[model samples]
Target: MSTIEKALAKQKTKAPATNDVVTEEKNTESNESVSVNPAPAPTEKFDIFIDNEKLTERGFLHTGGNTTNQQEEFRHIKRKLINNAFGPASKTLNNSNLIMVSSANPNEGKTFVSINLALSIALEQDKTVLLIDADVLRPSIHRELEFENSTGLLDYLCGDTDDVSQIIYSTNLNNLKIMPAGKAHHLTNELLASDRMATLSKELSSRYPDRLVIFDCPPLLGVTETPVLASLVGQAAVVVEESKTKLETIKRATSSLNEDLAIGFVLNKTIKTSKDVYGYYGYGYGRKR
Candidate 1:
């Protein structure tokens, strides 16, 4: 079973913990029903085409395919994420709508999860999701979605672009927009850690209260910027490659994150059983230290 499912089962059989999932969407049971035909939230900018077929062939969640196991699996995970963003968890964390998805190390399926999660959130009846490729050191969202390498997050961060809207593009996928990592620069660390980033984070949070921002960050262990970026977002989903991600490395990676951040671990590439997908997510309250 997925961690969320396991946690729900545990809740049914035992006392609830501070980390249990809260706030089921009132329109429908969040973990059970997938909302269809979400009205597209319009945005002004270049039009981008997301190749659903290409993404399906890549084993990512099929946004266009409504009945697939991939879609259902992500639907379950995104509910918990959305709950933490807009539900009771929002009051506790800063910029609770902004979620950062990273990994202990590279090649652990963080980008894959980030994309699928965004797509799944776009399926929501009353929510929109913005997927930002913040892995400036090694960007992947554009390539994975088959969009042209375009100017994006780094361009704005480095003052190459005066407007953030120019970097965020509207996709054919309803209610989902994207911001690519833009051109890489030697000053990437400085640009990402600068004060301008803080201002942008606030704008993103307050400007769209119903939108969830997903930052696809670089792996946490080796990259200095990931931790720095982590501080800017309220929630962090650390993608842990099953069997390969060591216990010490996962703890070390998360230790660098801010104490106020709502942290969660996503177990990726597991042997899929009848009751679960290849990934599982279990979120918890942040440590006070």
Candidate 2:
């Protein structure tokens, strides 16, 4: 087990047992006492808006709700990721919770996978998730989530916002939050590769060790910024469109990533053939060790 898991196990084992007799006495007294009702606490609201129809149409698991097939597939995928993040394998990772999702080229469904993976991880009882729109050149996460464009990672890195928390927006899904890609800038690549970005990355990983931070980055082979961001994250998942993306492209794209980072490939939009008894279009994972 990892140190974190061992500690949690130990804590659970050492927890105090409930006192049944004391609870019975308190309940007996409460039954004889007068009852007074209290007002309910106000629900926390977020400024962002989510279009359910759009989200459903895009195959995203509904926020704070449930789905069938897609949700199950992502749950299986996220399980392996979480194990790599916090299990015995995580010892070599600098910030195991910080993960980036990208593809070799555009329209490979990287953003779609990124958002789904984040949502699935958020469904876990013990962890929270922060989905960051890292594709500054053509940010699509806000558009995917149906939220208006706002300040985010770039704004904080460029000194436009001193506090990073200001850029993070909470969602109706209690455990999920988002960091939108801020307004477009000419020097977006330079800003992402800057020392400021490195500091912010460290701060994010350390501040909330239990939070899973998923970055929806640009395509690897064609984009300069994705590689830079990949180097900072401890783990990365490359989304490859099955039967469409070439083996050479996958190799070339993954070559840019840091060798120390744990790399995995997600075969997306796979179509079932006559050889397969079950016909389903979904994603599958393969680890690159």
Candidate 3:
């Protein structure tokens, strides 16, 4: 073959190699573009909403109460209930700092309200708060806070350690601490009513008098735990599901409680209508439906 023929053959082979390089570069660029532009976040799902990290943010909208007004309204109710008690919530909280939250039935949003109330209390700068998931049968506050479920009140009561301080866990919130319930046992009520539980509370109250201790106990109806649990704590809060809970049911629940125990009733999943708010705020309460 001539020199030009040989050169032409070489160019033809080199052309295919150059084209392959171009194709590979184009594919790489396309993938880079796809990687850079991700799909928009889905906010519609229930699990996404509940499990979202932003849901736990201090002032994030729609997680607990929707707006500032709603938070203030709930806070006012908390204050009023605290005020109506004999020594007042502030004084009682200052003195002993132990608060127990319970309900008439299981699926009544008791845990939700208890967790939120603890958050509300923790928002206060000066107050240091400890939320104990004393509901041994089914503990959720620990899961909600996304803390380790390894150690807590159960460990302390079972004499896992002499120091209760080992169980206390610090969270993102400045003043708030958590004591999550460990493995569930068969006889929770008896364990709770034992001397160890009482000793733990007494020691905690004495150790951190300025700190608020919120105990999420079992329901009032299903088990005898609430009454037994209430007897141990200084005060109790009953979470009544709004629209679902009847007056008779609430009355029955109140009857179950001893009159001496200062119990405050909280309406959970409460809907606000025109009657609840003036014409100014429109219909919806939290995060615009």
lDDT for each candidate structure: 0.76, 0.73, 0.57
For candidate 3, write residues 24-140 as lDDT tens digits: 111121111111121223222111112324443532213222235555554554454334332444453422356778878888877776676666665553466677898888888
lDDT by residue (tens digit), candidate 1, 1-289: 4322343344334322333232323334542323233323223335577666677678776544346556666777677778888899899989999999999889999999999899878767678888999999999888888777678888888888775556777676657788899988898889988998888888788777789999999998887999889889999888888789998888888888998888877777875666444445443333433
TM-scores, one per candidate? 0.81, 0.78, 0.68
Candidate 1 lDDT trough over 10 residues, lowest sum = 15-24
For lDDT, candidate 1 versus 3, the one ahead is 1
Sort every candidate by TM-score, greatest first. Answer: 1, 2, 3
Clash pairs detected, candidate 2: none
The residue ranges of model 1 lying beyond 4 angstroms of the native Cα positions read 1-45, 273-289
- The count of residue-pair clashes in candidate 1 stands at 0
lDDT (Cα, tens digit) per residue for candidate 2, span 44-76: 332355544566766676542333556556767
| Superior by lDDT: candidate 2 or candidate 3 | 2
RMSD (Å) per prediction: 12.0, 10.8, 20.9
Clash number by candidate, in order: 0, 0, 0
Clashing pairs in 1: none
